[model samples]
Target chain A: EADIYQTPRYLVIGTGKKITLECSQTMGHDKMYWYQQDPGMELHLIHYSYGVNSTEKGDLSSESTVSRIRTEHFPLTLESARPSHTSQYLCASSSSDRNTEAFFGQGTRLTVV
Target chain B: AQSVSQHNHHVILSEAASLELGCNYSYGGTVNLFWYVQYPGQHLQLLLKYFSGDPLVKGIKGFEAEFIKSKFSFNLRKPSVQWSDTAEYFCAVDIMNRDDKIIFGKGTRLHILP
Candidate 1:
């Protein structure tokens, strides 16, 4: 089974509420990524981390921020949520080796009211 | 910039029907191709991948993909699909020696009718 896990399988919050989406992996992978997707749409890369204290923005611009203080944890935070931020957030992790496939989490479906 | 394209947005088929989904990528150098499947309410899982050698790669669940480097395409195919195969399929490309991020296509939703 894949070791990656994401919390809050579904969330519904009012606009302007602060929220944090948690993602953890026990695989000890050094590379992790976060992607956002609307229903029936393509997934867009939002953020990624190479390792502890290493974070980079992805192709898609997002208002969320992520931190990688621990090897097993990479959490995304939204200071103030909006309806526009409502989407499914997927977390994945892969080995540093080239051509390795990534393992994904169950994903969190966020709905900002 | 590297990008992946999936030709079909939605496909409906009956049981025991042959399946083929088109995927194309825009990359000149060496690349690693991948196909991922996502069932309803499930996370994405690797369907198949092609790195080197054998142009034809077989994956789990009786699915396969052919890599045509000259055409810059890697299309997924299944001889006979079942109702359980209904899911969303995504084509992805990883440009070798570039970056670690894998580019994903828009995805194709496949619905199999019993």
Candidate 2:
């Protein structure tokens, strides 16, 4: 398994509440990414960070924001959760080398009702 | 813009069956390719990847993928599959241009019935 870990493996919260999904890796990789996926559906890139303090939105326009305060930590936050935010959030990290493969955390399943 | 496509959405097969999942990408530049698998209640795991060199790349769990640059396709194949192979498989592409922010296909769910 990847050294990456995600907190609150599963979460169910009320709509309009604020929440943050935590992701941390011990591999010391410089690149981290977040993807949103529905069960058995497509995985959409929501956010990514090249390194500390370098975060960017992905092809998918997500309402959530992400921060890369540290190399091992990347967190995604929702200002106001909604049903549309209900999905599996995946966190991954890879070495700075262009050819290295990415490793993924177990994922966080969030349900906003 | 780049895109990855998995032609098969859901597949049903019996044990010992040969497997093939089509994956094609649309990118005019050099890129990296990967296949990831996610079992029920588990996080995604890298099955294999092709960064350079040989067209055929072998991955974990007896799976392999062939990167056909001419076709702009990286299709995954396994000679013989087991019931344990049942899982959701995803094809991803990371163009060298964008710091390699990977893009994933809509995934293919395989069911290996015993």
- Which candidate number would show the highest lDDT if scored against the true structure? 1
- Candidate 1 lDDT (Cα, 0 to 1): 0.95
Docking tier of model 2: it is high
Residues A46-96, model 2: lDDT tens digits: 999999999998989999999998999999999999999999999999998
TM-score of each: 0.98, 0.97
Candidate 2 TM-score over all chains jointly: 0.97
Q: Could you give the fnat of all candidates in order? A: 0.66, 0.94
lDDT of 1 at B101: 81
DockQ per candidate: 0.81, 0.91
**Per-residue lDDT of candidate 1, residues A8-33 (tens digit):** 99999999999999999999999999
User: What lDDT tens digits, residue by residue, belong to model 2 across residues B20-48?
Assistant: 99999999898999999989888888899
Chain B TM-score per candidate, please: 0.97, 0.97
As a whole number from 0 to 100, the lDDT of residue A109 in candidate 2 is 95
Model 1: per-residue Cα lDDT over B1-114, one tens digit each: 778999999999999999999999998998889999999989999999998999999999999999998999999999999999999999988777646687899999999999
